[model samples]
Target: MMGLSYFWIDGGTYLGFIVCITLLMFILIMRSFDLKLRRKFTRVAMAMIIALAAGALELGLLAKGDTSTLIYAALLLKYILEGYMEIAVIRIVGRDYKKIQSKLLWIPFIVISILICTAPVNPSVFYFDSTLGLFVRGSLGYSIFIEAGFYLLVGLCICVKKWFTGYQRDALIILFMLAVVSTGVLLEEAYIFDNCTLTSSSIGVLFVYVYMYAERYNVDSVSMCYKRRCFYSDAAKYAKQEMAIISMDLNDLKYINDNYGHQAGDVALLTFAEVCRSVKTNKFILYRTGGDEFMILGIKSSQKEAENLISIIKEKLKETPYTCSFGLHMYKPGEDFEEAVVKADKAMYDDKHIYKSNKNKQANKRDDRFDEKVQSFSNDIDFFDEGE
Candidate 1:
């Protein structure tokens, strides 16, 4: 379009176009599947495609003619999209995707964007060199990479934190993602390779999707907590550690289902799980082992710590309409893990028994009050009849 006789695609543009098309296909396939965080995945994939397309366009323009405003604008858009992808990918780790923390992470991107927008007036962020027909980084040009790296670091930290919480597989998957994207960015930035960033990112997104798809099998769909197999696996993994098992069961789940519907029952389970999560630490891992039954494995915990954990959970449960009964058992260094689980199970059943007994007692008291009021009314009626 710029009227250069030789206008052909370079290696970078070819790779970018290829990666962009692949990402578009990935998005289509991803939409067909029902996955948790599906929207977030789609958003990042779309952003990646856009970024790749912009990068390819800039490369083609650079090949055709001298550097111009259009090329600079394309570069700016690519940077912004890259920054967004970093932040969005990190958000997949937890619930922060739409939270204030995620929004706060955007501040750096906004600042960078404003600086890039004023490049015409001030070339400190980035400028084009017409003499060499090249795009050159200005003083603040490094800011974009620094910003992208900051998000990658944040994502890596979150994954590391989750690793300590017994999410080894999930955390490792995220770490792999960071590694891939970081390598891509390094390759492009260091001139080691051209137009490979988009390809690497696309591969990373695919890996994450595969991991997430596998994760669904190990996760409780309703509560989004680890399932029975994960619990078993983690229990054995932490068997040598000074761990405590906290077994919990929701009270009146059947009642909720019968009276309010199964959907309400699901809400109760989710609520109980959330309460447990709120009180859990890095030393603790929460699992939904069965319907209305959950467990927490607390690493390096004492009986007293388990008690405090239960207490905190109870207080949180009071705010919700549902309640949970808990049983705590500290594992001896060499004790059978299943035996320890059984002990915890027994304790939980005992707690459940107590909870049921107290509930029945309250019900009986209400019934007794009703009977007395009825008797009092009947006696007053007989007295009025005699007086008449």
Candidate 2:
């Protein structure tokens, strides 16, 4: 309080107080929800609270803009919490968030954070403008912004592209939130808005809770698809639309589990899930119905569209140890969804039958060739015994 500006007494203090109170209320509301969701989003709650606290510290800097200690500490907390927020959202959404971890970026981020923290030793990263009575960017200020921009973009890409059950509409919500926060930060940096970025971040984090984490009941944790429950609910709703339902089963899952071990089978299953996710468009939703079986509900879809989606998976078949067989059916309005599903299932079994047949034929052919080679060798030996 001695050196820092009194954020409340200032004209802008009211707005900050309102935003901070909202964040606190949000934390309490989330805690009252399902126990599992509370445990799941604990990191997000912590991160948002830390961000709020940083904003409070930020107000302390208005009085003593020249003192870099409080501001630097605030910034450090903000950056760390930003990372945590992204990771938490991605995790709850069932994305393999670990795939984005980069050992290469870690060193640079650590170095930059350390450099920014030691602001008093040198003023290149940031300095207090006594004339304006505000903290201004030093030489490395732009670099810090760039790094923040990179982090925000990474978070967006992780969630928007790979996670979220209803990715089309849901992913857009995430993208929009990120954009709002980024715009606020940019405006603040340009001195157009006072303390805009921090406020925007608090709002965005709250939205993330409501849109992504709160609605995660449908997301499948193991396969990263929507659960069967999600699929059935949407199927009934989309019955009137020109929908294509795809029934698929992983080929030879039992063989993989027996020969290579269950872990390998899991990898194969996850790999197939990734393939499904890769081919998914905004019009489609994928689900894991059973152990090795999956379904996709595609709006305004056709057999050709379904085949095209399958083709994309075929291209990536080389990347995995397993292959999948599928059947496509166009769901007619007024038709029993279960009947249509049964037909699609029959079609999938036909495909599986063909797959196994081909495999067996190949095996038989190999055996025949082996037998022929052995007979020829025996005849040659008999001729040599007769002294050719």
Candidate 3:
């Protein structure tokens, strides 16, 4: 029994060492990429360091046959540090932390903290003593349940955030952390049940280290909407089906930014995007290609059908303050995708030039009205002075 307990303690400490070393290496490698360290990196490193120290202390307590208050404190410290690190990462990633969905993430941390608090006070009730009579503290049910719940939260955050925005590399790292913690909890349960001769937590921690190394050294690729990569990967698969591509560019966007502030320019862009989304006819994929340029692809019947859809979009924009120039193109059999895109782009540019010309003409008319007013006021003042 003593030998087995020693083995578990040693295994946990080894796992902690592996996790810490990997994290340190990961930090060094991340510096090579963006090197910003941001706030997320600092918190993550601190949390892992504390966890490693706690694991060492846990082994010490096991060897002494007395679980000291300091060891318990260290364990709680590790949990709190890890939880805060996750929250920090979420903030640094600029996710919608105020949303209701984020509350799900806190639930596991809260439950786990409560369980760990109760474990020392009610060890016999919470934990099961092994056949060898070792007091393997902490409830397997709560541990596994909380770990799995956290994993789900992290995974959902990663997948959903990536789907909406292209920034997902940090989220992927969070997912890796979730996997490591989950595997540790599961292995601990297996060890408690005597189903496993060795705890696999160390191996899991090692995997986490490898993932960190990969994240640090590897160039993280960003997902783009209209880029050739995503288009070929997704559009080609749907090439056999009818697809309508509508290309658009915001009218007078540069003029707006130059006349007004950039903030107003941003508002115009956001408003245009919202208007486009609201005018959705069917299942459509929207892409922002260049500055003030966007495209919407939908499954449609023919070129005329695509034009009708663009006409509807134009009507929707007419109701709004901003206007956009649009061009429609339907994917035809044997048509090169890039060439078709270029044709659509050229059409949109032609429309954009026409819109800009009309806008300039209107501005000239307004200038003429202002000049007429100024001349009439000056003539009236001169006549009044002569009469005096």
Candidate 4:
């Protein structure tokens, strides 16, 4: 007997629609995000908006007490859109899903869709009671909840995987959002509130958007690498474990800028970053700590492996016209991370000094050869004049 006003007054659906529409517009209009990320957010925002809109349609039809087929159609569309929302959430949060595992996720969705479609004929998933003017849950009515819960659980597993792989902060944020959605679902299932699930999902999406937007500050826009602020934060997380730190400084960044242009200097920095990314494994992270300074933090890497990585980087740089000075230090389990970084810094300076000394020696040798050639020519001219 609830009217359309009651549906709007509930506030959950209305608020959710506003949030979703805003997000969709932001995703479509924003130029800062990559295509892949824009696509992900777009899918999620569209799915949520559609799902909430379908819910509203179903509610409106139910309020009218119409025995027409439109109510059933509306209900079916709502259920299917809800399922898509679950799938879209999963896709947005995780990137490790394999092709086979991804295909398997669709199986449950297909089964739920089939069950929903059959409800009109077999009354398996849900049945409309014209006598009571109400829709009643059937034997398989709980399938949608189960399916949604399953997707949430899968998302949790992905978060845990990220946690163990050294992305603790990011994983924690995602887990918190999933927990919010989970609470909403539990509340709705308990009949304590209506539209709690969709509202919660919208709120979760908002949190993620805010968190991601804030994360932009942690990235260095020039080189597209993590900034100095994140380096200290991420390094502190490895205080209790053995870690490897590599300090790198470009050899002649100022020279490049003064001789060429600042734009050329930026190209050199980006080239270095691209090479580092190519040689870095999943266990390593790159951070640009200063204008010409960068650092590599490695998890569970040995000294030999670190040295080999340096060699690989040097070899890669040979393909270009630039070079970098490097220093490697292994941080023991009980040692201070800052002290290890200091040692790495000292080593990098010593290496830089050696590079400069070698360059000067080669320049002196070239100068001596030029002087000898000039002296020999002068002697030849003098001897020819005396003979004449």
Candidate 5:
């Protein structure tokens, strides 16, 4: 028969193993779905695995009737793993990929993992040995103290990262506080000073889970700028503001796409949108309502101010290789916003026609010049031939 410690087959051990397996499976399934989501959930799953393993080890020690040394080791391992996992999740989700790999931030954690796995005298295992009572006591005290020091160091690292990154937000602040509390409790446990207080890391874990769920599923699905739902909401609330709607469309966009390819068309649209962002003053909210069309909503000042703004935009376009046509309409207070938009769109179409006419006139003038040049060349050729 296998050497069975009293805690090895205990109910708690079985329960912990079951929980650990379930969490591991959950993480694997999440990874199968989407890469981004997998990256977000990996830390949570890893943390749960560590916690469950520690709990199972504790139960095993109890079953073996040698709980003292193993319990402290298991608990210390659990707390340290929990802190690392929590901070790792925050960093992964909050940072872009370049930031994650730049400073070799994962190195310390890898070293810690190797140490935990290969340490000859696992304080937890030492505590549970019946023949070494004094040895167990000393090891437990030393191990707990070391773990507490490590936790404090980890907390300091997190604080420094947050300071340089300027990530002093709600979730991070709560995490920093929890780390401090956990460090203090571990220190108390190490010194045998007093009854260790309950650290809030467990509760903070719950809060983080809730936050992740809400962030993943609860928000509107519109594109980043001027969401469709928000537009309706704001329209309802600010109906009394003297609104002006400007509608714009890129000129000869289809021609450009056909000649240069869709990639060039995309570049054109992005360039035009950037120009719009630059010209649209702080007072205006810009929306790309459809392909090749955009809308800007703002409080109407005077017609002269609006005209001046449009004139400045036109001057800027003269320097660019492509042009766009715009139509503007000022809304009277209590007027229908939809009606104003339609009027602006009509004005834009009219402007497009005007632009096309001017372009055609320029092209005709060029053609006439080419024809005159060809006639002059023919006359020169005839005169040279006659002289020869």
Candidate 6:
């Protein structure tokens, strides 16, 4: 029998325990965090747990003796578990399984599991070698590579696409780690190594979770503003306080996007976010509540203070070339926060419409002036010619 030291089972077990405890601690501590983030932590943690089991079973697969039915069955089970773990990693990288794209991507991996379940009968992916007394592969053996490399590329694409908004450094590190895991998996496929898959995956997943823990603000990726989820949490936390809501909406954002590009629209949104966040005050909090809309929740007792903050926002916005309209609402004690937000949103739309109409009128007025001046000049030239 092969010695235990060659398998690295001890190291894998220790890493698995560390990852499990870290995830549980984070879940317990971040109870107030958004459900999506918490769910990701839980899923990754559970995947690591299963990975630990799979690693142990792999040790049996490599046992130095005639392969039995039980060992073969364990191999098939490990394949199934690895497929599930892959889906989990994909979800973590994409972060939106409910979306159509995400659903389409992961739904195929189920087919991999189905294929794996049939491995014992067909041995297309893997089977026991009765002659050489080892695990061997069939003609369709590369299905494993097709399944893993596919999602690894997809996940890498997702991570690379989200390289900005505080995830750039994280993405590069994650890419390196995943590359290491991929190399280890490839090595095992060639029968060139053992236990590398579980060890590399555990280390990579642990690093990802640690990075996420350090950056757990529920931050909106595009605008870098506090996300909408935080709005609900904060509202519930401060529901009883007297507060003023300032609803800000970017003017002509659709025009900007349609004219310049979506990138420019993103730039405008980011600019608005920076202006709101940079405003000096601890009593006020900024949120990008919606596309082209933002909110500043002032916790102080005065409506005038809210207005003053809005005024400051306007002044800061003028310094930039972009334009936005804001609505100010003072919430009475015991008033519903949502109701106050609605009022502010309504006021913001009213202001935005007025702003657009005034700009149109100003353009028309300038056009009229140009026409009148041209007419006067033409009349003067005609009179002078007639006199000559």
Q: Which prediction has more favorable TM-score, 3 or 4? A: 4
Best by the lDDT measure:
4
Q: State every prediction's TM-score relative to the real structure.
A: 0.76, 0.71, 0.61, 0.64, 0.46, 0.55
Alpha carbon lDDT of each predicted model: 0.74, 0.66, 0.54, 0.75, 0.54, 0.68
lDDT of 1 by residue, 304-368 (tens): 88899899999987666667888989987789999999999999999999988888889877446
Best by TM-score: 1
Off by over 4 Å in 5: 1-223, 227-230, 251-283, 299-323, 354-388
Per-residue CA lDDT of candidate 2, range 247-333, in tens? Answer: 999987786677556765666676788777776786778889998999988899777888898888878775544578888888989
Stretches > 4 Å off in candidate 4: 1-9, 96-101, 219-225, 232-342, 346-388
Candidate 6 local accuracy as lDDT? 0.68
List model 5 lDDT by residue over 94-181, tens digit each.
3422344334555555555545543336554334455542224333334433544554565555555543432234337546555645
Task: Residues 278-352, candidate 6: write the lDDT tens digits.
Answer: 663667777788888787777764888788777887898765556789898887768877888899989998999
Candidate 2 clashes between residue pairs 3 or more apart in a chain or in different chains: 4-60, 5-63, 124-139
- Ranked candidates, highest lDDT first: 4, 1, 6, 2, 3, 5
Poorest lDDT segment (10 consecutive residues) of candidate 2: 379-388
RMSD of each: 11.5, 11.8, 12.2, 14.5, 14.9, 16.9
- Residue 57 error for model 6, in Å? 2.4
Better of 2 and 4 by lDDT: 4
TM-score of 3: 0.61
lDDT of 3 at 103: 55
lDDT of 5 at 43: 56
Residue pairs with backbone atoms closer than 3 Å in model 1 (clashes): none
Worst 10 residues of 4 by lDDT: 379-388
